[model samples]
Target chain A: MADISAHTPTSEIRSAYLEMTHRKRLYSGLMLAVFVALMVSGFVLADDRNAGGFWSGLHRLFDFPAEVLSEASEKLTDLPAHFVHFLPSLIETVNIAAASTLFGAMIAIVLSLLSTRGLARWPRLIPVFRRIMDITRAMPEIVVALVLIFVLGGGPVPAMIAIAFHTAGALGKLFSEVNENASLKPVEGLQSVGAGWIQRMVLGIMPQVAPNYLSYALLRFEINIRASAILGFVGAGGIGYDLKNAMSWGKGQYDEAAAIFLLLFGTIVIVDQISSALRDRLTHGARLEATL
Target chain B: MTTVTTDVITDLKGRADTLFLRKRLLGFALPAAVLVYLAYIFFAFDIPGLADRANLDNGKTLIRDSYSYKTHVTLDNRSGDITYAIEGERKGTYPDGMRPDWVSDRDGMTVVDLGRGNSVQFAQGFARIVQQDGLTVTARPDRDGVNADLPAGPLPDMISASKNRLMVTLPDARVTVTRNRVEVFKYAFGWELFFFTLDSPYHGMGFPTLLSKAVSGEAGAIWDDFWGNAMWRHADVAWALFETILMAFLGTFGAAMVALPLAFLAARNFTPLMPLRFAARRLFDFFRGVDALIWTIVLARAFGPGPLTGALAILITDTGSFGKMFSEALENVDGKQIEGIQSTGAKPVQRYRFGVIPQVTPVFLSQVLYFLESNTRSATIIGAITGGGIGLLLTQAIITQKDWEEVSYYIVLIILMVMVMDWLSGLLRRKLIKG
Candidate 1:
């Protein structure tokens, strides 16, 4: 905290200021150097462990995509048929996302209510329920899916349950955040009427927070679509499974692979666009309602 | 004028009524649609056939294996040799002369105490089982398959009888007899060999005893035994856990570093050229649309398989997301702040450094931190595909079809890892952003 310029003449202030700035610059430079070293060493270590070298693999990066694209163009006439062939699988993937989101949202509502302060049925057990949500949310979808596939056999059900489990945990946290901003007046009014817990939640909290919940759910749905596709690649059943098969076939099946890639990409973009649009409207409408 | 006023009031009333009517209709229609969709899914997913295909026994095995380990007491009929093992694995085999308290070797006869007065006596010629209910079951190997003599009444459901084998299922224990061997499995709670395998000297020592030994300068020995546990593979699991976190760290930070500069190019305020900005935005879209799953696949081809490939996949996919988010943040940067800095005759670079970065750092940093937490979960899935990290180990264990205990262990560790990262990121965000 000492200032060397304070005890010196007025002329020394500029020199002291410059000295301080130089020291600050030196500290920042050192920090930057350390960061650079970490990144470089980490990259090297990763490259060493990797099966393929980084530099050699860089040029070949576009090879697979190019092959698939060229082959699809060559068989352009079969593109429509391939699209038809994969449509059902695409539907299945979407269904998985939709059902999981529906089920997960249902569970998340209760969990959020339980975990949120001032809204908890049993305040003492709020931490328990919150931790439960945390653990469930922390579990990656593939862990449960793979484990369920072992017991349930390979099917969409495993994927559905796994995704729903994770979705519940994730949506639960977001729902609770929304719940925190909700007015307690409605809840108190319902309580004065001697309504039951479920009744109070449905008639009081549900109406107040419906818009935010809907928006968050829409976002989750968009995410779940991508997750479902990825799960399919791991053999949970969907277009992802077919894509994997076609991919493994290497050269001959590039057309089918391209079709799948297109389907997945198109579905994702469309869903994202639709959901974002819906979310925008929902929030805008809510703001309008507030103004009115 | 009076008629006009009346007409307007009536029109407003009609509109309100119609709105409520539509709302009511939608309430019913939405539920109806959801029900119809669910019905479609039920058949589409073949839920009806799921019941037939579901292996309830596998569920039972998984649930049981997660909590309880069965110690196998085997009597080799051919060699007249007796051995005891946990989960029937050699890694859990007892030492040369050491055995569990429940099992006693009396001369040539092996007697397994199945608890609560249920004991199985294995001998050279025959095996005898004492049931908790006082039913004495005896099986003798003969030419006409093993002959079993039971109480003269009808056989109970707990006992399975066949020409080749006789089996008795107990709540705490089980006894099975075949032509070749008689085996008894006693069920116990908790994971066995979690700290020290059977070969270790510290296998059955209580926690208090271990602590005392540690205080007596045996700490290294204890640590070595626990760390090198063959059945659990603590060392490998730890390494896999580190690799998973490393993947997330390298990916999230690396993407942030790459995206920050690129974001300036995409930001409309920073880049006046329409075509260049459009191209940059399109590139972001391409990467985002391709997504982490496809990116992982493509990268794994060039990178082969490791944490590096998974990290790069995350880096590429997240670069797109960060670029889009960061460009928007940059575009929204306060023009007044930059103008103020410029009024001091500061260069463009210095103006951005002083005015723009400080404004956007908190928002961008928060976004990056959030991604850091999420990418940890993503890394697990990516690692499974790329053949690295705990995810790979989990799949391998699950595929082997029996190591449900190890699967459960890995799952617990993964959940713990995510929770820790979640806590750590939250802490870092509060500290760095607020400070």
Candidate 2:
């Protein structure tokens, strides 16, 4: 047999071994520092107030309304007052969220198209658009709410506008990213056949990315729904208005608040299940196509 | 041959022309019109006024004049010569017409001499009043003087006394004077005070009163008042913020965490199982199908109200997002490394640990940190539900009719908090992921 050891250089082998050991030590030190930092930070920030005063107070404040609600239920001798109080607001909240999602998605679709780098002929415009998108996404929805509240007055309009603007920025960015990553083969083929920019996008790009776009749009809708409900707190008009009123009432309205909360929790769970199922179905179909 | 070529060219031209027309109508004109209309509406709306309509000045006057006083004085007669002194300020001369002379002491309170006729009258009240030559007056009430009442009009703009019974020059500035233990009103409008007044509400709503009385300004007092009474009183509003947070968290982490399992299935290198990979990919697509906020509304109806509702909504939506992200990360993992691990006869679990996990952990951690920061803001949106956190406070401040000061305060706080959190999280992520 040939002397394999002679063929390989001893220096190269030794250097490789040294490099591996150095890497291991460096990694170990880094991990140790990270672990120590996490522990120290957690301790430093931990709330130290007495449980009786802080936690109990919070619990009592949150639970008092539930107690009253249960009492009211007993006294009324009819349908549960908790349910009755919360049901309407819950429905309205849902409706507002749904409507906003639909509208936001519609707005996002147009914005996403404008945001696409490939669609823009001007290279300079691409970075500008990207930066604009980043800033828009960077701004918190509350800031948007504050600005819109001034323009739209104390109503759902401000909330809707805030939600819509944010959704547009976020969805636009996602859409553009999807577009960038999409298969260029079909686009090139269309271009070779003398298709224009719009033709290539519509026929080649859109077809490939449509499923992803739809999925994203649906996901945004869910987010918008939750967002719309809270918009009422800022005078944007939603179920949150009722919640604010109840909370302001303090001790007396706990039960109603709890009931409302429960309703909200329930609503989300149901929507989550439904959307998840739908998502599964859609993804499963995509997977089947990929396998073929 | 020329006829055939011309006919083919005409057909091609016709097809291109038709296609252009279709594109213009559907892609350009329609969207453009919609955009214009929407922009018009946004521009057309009137924003709320920034100014507070409440008369805070009147309340400030009440507080200043009604409660703030230094000395107590009463006069038996209006024409009596009186002398008075504050221990710390000064004591020199009083005007001849009003009072005789007064002496300063180490303590704040001082006694003054009154002229003959004024002496008896000054004795009934607390201090004797001596008319000063300049704009100053030296007034000292008798020690027994207690019944001196405030003038019925708005509180006096300024008050000062000469040191002794000699006249003294007075500045054109406003000052506060009190006698007979009555509250003195000071109308001095320093810029800091003025600004504070502007930011605060008038009467019960003003910041000074609220800060001094309601919030107490003690350590943890503001937090207690805001979180407990103010925030709890508006539970729905507070809860809404919690909901927003739940939305962001669930949307981010729920999706991200689930994405890991799905990612394994979707990753071709690891799975090698085509059906599983395809199924996982489809799963990611389905979850990522819609925007998170949309999911919130849809879920809000089904789930009802609270953080759970928001969280579930976010979770379902984010799962799709994370699934796509994680799978992409998985796909990009080095195949040779995984093959090397497999060559060692490592089980699938071990392969993931030694091969995939190490490769993806840094990316995953960074992504999680980014999402966590993003979600903090998202929580504010979901908190609009009426019961939760800062969002509720924010909305209420806006709605309670031009509580802009509070609105500004809360907005600043939230923004600062978010920025700090983002920075901290970024630092942490870098530390965690560092080689």
lDDT of 2 at A149: 56
Q: Candidate 2: where is the Cα deviation over 4 Å?
A: A1-39, A46-85, A121-123, A150-153, A182-206, A248-253, A287-292, B1-363, B379-435
> Best candidate per lDDT, number?
1
Q: Please state the error at residue B156 of candidate 1 in Å.
A: 1.3
Candidate 2 positional error at A276, Å: 1.9
After TM-score superposition, the amount by which residue B99's alpha carbon in candidate 2 deviates from its true location, in angstroms, is 36
After TM-score superposition, the amount by which residue A134's alpha carbon in candidate 2 deviates from its true location, in angstroms, is: 1.7
Q: What TM-score do all the candidates reach, one by one?
A: 0.95, 0.48
lDDT per residue (tens digit) for residues B88-109 in model 1: 9988999888888987867676
Q: How do the residues B257-283 of candidate 2 rate in per-residue lDDT, one tens digit apiece?
A: 677787778877668988888887776
Best by TM-score: 1
Measured by DockQ, the strongest candidate is 1
Clashing pairs in 1: none
Residue B383, candidate 1: alpha-carbon lDDT: 93
Model 2 lDDT per residue over A115-194, tens place: 66565545567777766665555556766766555544465566766777777777877888777777879988999999
